[model samples]
Target chain A: MRYLRLYLHFLRFSFSRAMEFRLDFFFKIIMDCMFYVVNLGFYKILFLTTPMLAGWSEDQTMVFVSSYLLVDALHMTVFASNMWMIPFSINRGDLDSYLTRPVSTLFFVSLRDFAANSFINLLMAIGIFAYTLMNLKAPYTTGQLLFYVGCILNGWLLHYVLQMIFIIPVFWTQSSRGFSDFFFSMGVAIERPDLVYRGVLRWLLTLVLPFALIVSFPARLFFGPETPHLFLHLVFVTLAAWGFMLWFWKKGLRAYSSASS
Target chain B: MSWPARVVSTELRKILAYRSDFWVNFLGQTIIQLFIARALWQSIFESNGQTEIGGFTLSQMTLYYLLAPLTIKILMGENIGFFSREIYDGGLNRYLVWPLPPIGYKLLTYLTYSAFYTAQLALLYTFARFFLDDRPYELSEFLRLIAGLGYILVAAIGYFCMMCLCELVAFWADNTWSLGVMLRFVAGFLGGTFLPLSFYPETLREIIQYLPFAAFISGPVNLILGRSTPMEALQSFVVMLVWLPILGLAVRALWKKGNLQYTGVGM
Candidate 1:
């Protein structure tokens, strides 16, 4: 409950900050909206040449694309700003304040800023997700719909964990944006179906980096036939990622040499 | 040496200090993009059971993707927020006292970065060619490549001027970073950084091909690939030539007006 109050305070502070720059706020929304349009257009054009991509039809792939867009929008709204600031904080020893806070440092650092600018984009993403779901040929049952929503949340958490895993390396590297750039580069893997990848690349995306599990598996759960093993795999990977993030966070903190010290 | 030449040399020296950043930005990002684009096009071709799509063989498409990242790096210009940061943080005051114009200095700095980036990409492409080993080229192709380089240089200047105009908005708006982000997103789509312009419908592709955005990336790339006819390539150069001076004038006018509004307090 105390953490909840702290998060509410964070939300209030973020809203006030966003409101201070009205033009920037609207510009950011427009920027993300453009991103969504381009993403949809890319797939639309690709589908014109082929009926199926990686065992999924155009409509099914549309759902997959919409799922990832929602996942990305959710991350932007909730986690991106905080993640972007982590390197700056570490470099300047501003993280010392985070460490000294009463709340959980990991929780505080990761969730401190809710990007109000991207909130409208988040709503737009949700609208697209719902629209795609309605258009899906295989009508989802209420229970399956609920499960798909849960998996989308799981995917968002997986994204956060994956980002922090990359970010924690700043403690040792001290090169701000290096790992993040690499992270962005690797993130393209999630844009396509994992089925397209063969052998080692498949294993790497599914088991190691696990970007495939983020959106693809959730979209698979809703659109494709039942894959009980895949659900278990997603659960296992998320838990393992969470565990690794906590361990890595502690390891990074222990190695942190504060600026003042 | 002229002032702009010295400025370029100084910027070249400054860039050498951040060698790791250059490698990470170029090699790390480009290799990943290459891998993803290869996998994507491979999947598309396999799914359709055809080796060609939209006039590009699979190898040709792979080559296109390979070149796209390098082309974007050169044409996009660096220091996206250079003018805005200077104006907002009162760094413009330092430039105002100097005899050299700030826009010229900025343009020289970007050109220096572009030169460094091209050299690095040349080395990277050499490494790539070692493995690929099948990019057949004749004398005309080499001539087209040279022509494409000239067009790219013009397009880079136009792009730089446009970005400077975008940054000059900081004189009025408190934060222009969002504008930069917006510009990048729009340009990435329209400029064919994400996909080939040929992927679009004929009417849309025709419209985009004449736009400054296509001149920035798609036009020059397609010219080098021998995808465009001589007339089409000439048309692209004409579009760039027209936009460059207009954008250059806008930057000059904006900078003059913005200088009047500047009050250097934070310094």
Candidate 2:
């Protein structure tokens, strides 16, 4: 309950900071939208050449792109700005200030830098998602939307938990920027659909890293409803990653030799 | 005797003193580029067959990605925006007091950073060669590679000078870091750092073909990939030369205007 209040305060402050500069807000929105438009343009070009890539139809692929964008925006809204700051805090011992706070140090540091600019990105992602869904003319029941939202919420948690786990090494290494980028690179797998994988890669996606589960399984809820097993796996994986991140954070906190010394 | 040799030696000594952050940043940057390149390559493979893309085979594409970041480091990824920092903090005041002219001091600082960036690029290239798959080039190809590299070098200098002009705006704006970031993004996206401009529509590509950003990275990468012949390469070089002097003049003009209106804030 206390943590929820802390998170709410962080979100409120972060949103205000984003809106602090009206021009910055509008420009960022336009810029991000232009980037998404380019991706949409890429898809249009590809579809003109062929109906499908790697065995998925245009509508299916659009859903894949939409899901990736949605998950990405969700991650940005919740975590990106904070994750990027971890390095600076570790290097400057600013994490120490957060540590001394009344709230959870992890929660404080992770949620402190709410990116105001990303609100536009978030809205844009939702708009694109809606357009894709409408184009597909897919049936939308309240139960389905609820489950879709639930899976995406779980997906967002999975992303955050993995990020925290990857960044935990910063406490021990004193610098983890390289590791962070590498994690992001590996995390790129989440952006593609799981249908694209085969054999060992499929098993790897399911069991080992589970990058495919991030976008694919949640998207499956909408596009491939027959895949109930994947949705269950998504929940399972999210819980497992959440547990791993919590364990790692605890161990990392013990190893944290405050930067001042 | 030459200006570059003189600046590079002093810069090398200074860079060595702060080598840890330098190497870490270089390695970190390389890793990010590699990942992005890998992701894009995977996408391309998924979309198209195992054929050449914009005249590059899969292995060659990876090689281009590997070299692109190193090329960026060599050309324009240094302290290209140091002028903005100096303008913001009134560090330009020191340059004004020096026996060397302020503009000359700024240019030397630019050269110094470029020197450090070159060393860092070399380190990254060494690391890349270990892990990345690239085809061997013939003697003639190596010559063309040199010519292409020259194009990127001049283009980087021209682009950096233009950025220095943007940084000079710090003399007027309350903060220009966002502008700097926006400018870099323009350069990166338009210049084909994120993805090649070749991927754009013919009309858009034709228009960007003339823009300063295309000349920065894409033009050179295309040249090195043997996508353009010597005539086209020479034409690109001519375009860069034309842009360089214009940007240099603009930098001077902005600096003069900024200094006149300088509030000497937060010095």
Candidate 3:
């Protein structure tokens, strides 16, 4: 119960702090939107010359793109902001305050960075997704919809865990900048449909790194509603990745010596 | 006795002092570009089988992508708008009092860093060339490639100077990073750094081709690919000449105007 209160306080603090930077908040929305718009334009051009891309129809591709945007926005808002703050907090020993709190240190760090501005992008993604679905003449069944929502949540957990695995190394690496860039770049894998990759790289994305699961699996639920097994596999992969990252985070904390010394 | 060479040598040694970090950053950037290009090329190939994209063969497109990181390394500075940092931190005050004219100082500093970056790009390009799956050009074509590289460098400098002109807004806007971010985003789209303008609709491509932003990447890429002749290169060069003087004048006027409004404290 006490931990709950502490988490809420951190959440409130994050909300208030984000509100203070109104221009930054709007800029964040615009930046995310512009990036998606460019991707959309690329798809438009790609489809202009060809009616289909890699067996995915124009509307199906649009859904995939929207899902990619939604996942990216969620990752940026929930996990990335917190992960980015970790290195700075550790370096400045500001992390000590969070460490000593009654709540879990992980909870404190992650919950303290709920970027409300990214909600704008999230909303835009949903609008686009809905619009594209209508255009495609696809109807969402209740079961399929439930599975999609579950997969999205699971994907978010998977994303947060993988981000933690990448970020936890900052304790030992001392500078997280390279790792941060790498993490973000790795996240770029989700921006494209999993179908684009082939052979060894495809296997790695599907099994090992499992980044494709972040978007492709949930997106598959919508696009290929008949393939429920893929959604279950995605959930299983998410769980495995979450387990690995949690273990790594604990190991990293043991290695962390406060930068103050 | 060349001014650029004089400036570059002094800058190279200073950068070399932190050589390990610099090399790591360069290597990391290169790897990222490689993978991204790999992903993009795979998609393009899958979409169109052996067909020309924007007049580029599959091999040519791969080469274009391979060359992108090197071009970015050569032409790009530490920051797109370092002038903003100068203005915000009162570093401009020091430049103001310098014996060299303000434009001369900006030009020299730009050259200094650019030369260091050029060496870095050359090293990386050589490394990429060995490993890259592309055919080498004939000797004559290779020489023309070098000339193309020179044109690209000059054009890049022209664009950077224009950005410096925009950074003069910092004299009014103060310390927000958004101005720089916004400008870089604009350039990323309009400059064909994100996606080549050739991929855009013909009407849109035509508009972008004449814009200052197109000179940043597409013009040079076309020049190297032999899409443009020597006369065409000369015309592009003349366009840059027109832009450089105009932007230089704008920067000077803004500097003088901004200086009048300068509170200097906290800015």
Q: How accurate locally is residue A200 in candidate 2, as Cα lDDT from 0 to 100?
A: 64
TM for chain B in all models?
0.92, 0.85, 0.84
| Native A-B contact fraction in model 1 | 0.57
Candidate 1: the clashing residue pairs are: none
Model 1 docking category: medium
lDDT of 1 by residue, B114-167 (tens): 767666555665466446647564688668766776677777788888788789
DockQ of each: 0.59, 0.19, 0.29
Q: Against the true structure, what is each candidate's TM-score?
A: 0.94, 0.80, 0.84
- Poorest 10 consecutive residues of model 2 chain A by lDDT? A176-185
What TM-score, to 2 decimal places, does chain A of model 3 have?
Answer: 0.90
* RMSD after CA superposition, every candidate: 2.2, 4.4, 3.9
Off by over 4 Å in 1: B1-6, B13-21, B126-130, B133-137
Best by TM-score: 1
What TM-score does candidate 1 get on C-alpha atoms? 0.94
**Candidate 3 lDDT, A1-261, residue by residue in tens:** 876776577668877887876756666677777777876776787676666665678888887787677777777766667777887786666777877876678887886777777777778877886777677756678787676767777777787877777677667656634265556556657766777777776787788888888877777667673465786688688878878877887886777676631
Best by lDDT: 1
Give lDDT tens digits, candidate 2, residues A1-261.
Answer: 988887778878877776666655665566566656655665665564445655567887787788778877877777887898887777667778888878778777777777777776998899998888777745677787777777777777777777777677767666535257556645646766666566666687666667777777777666654556766677787788777888888887787777731
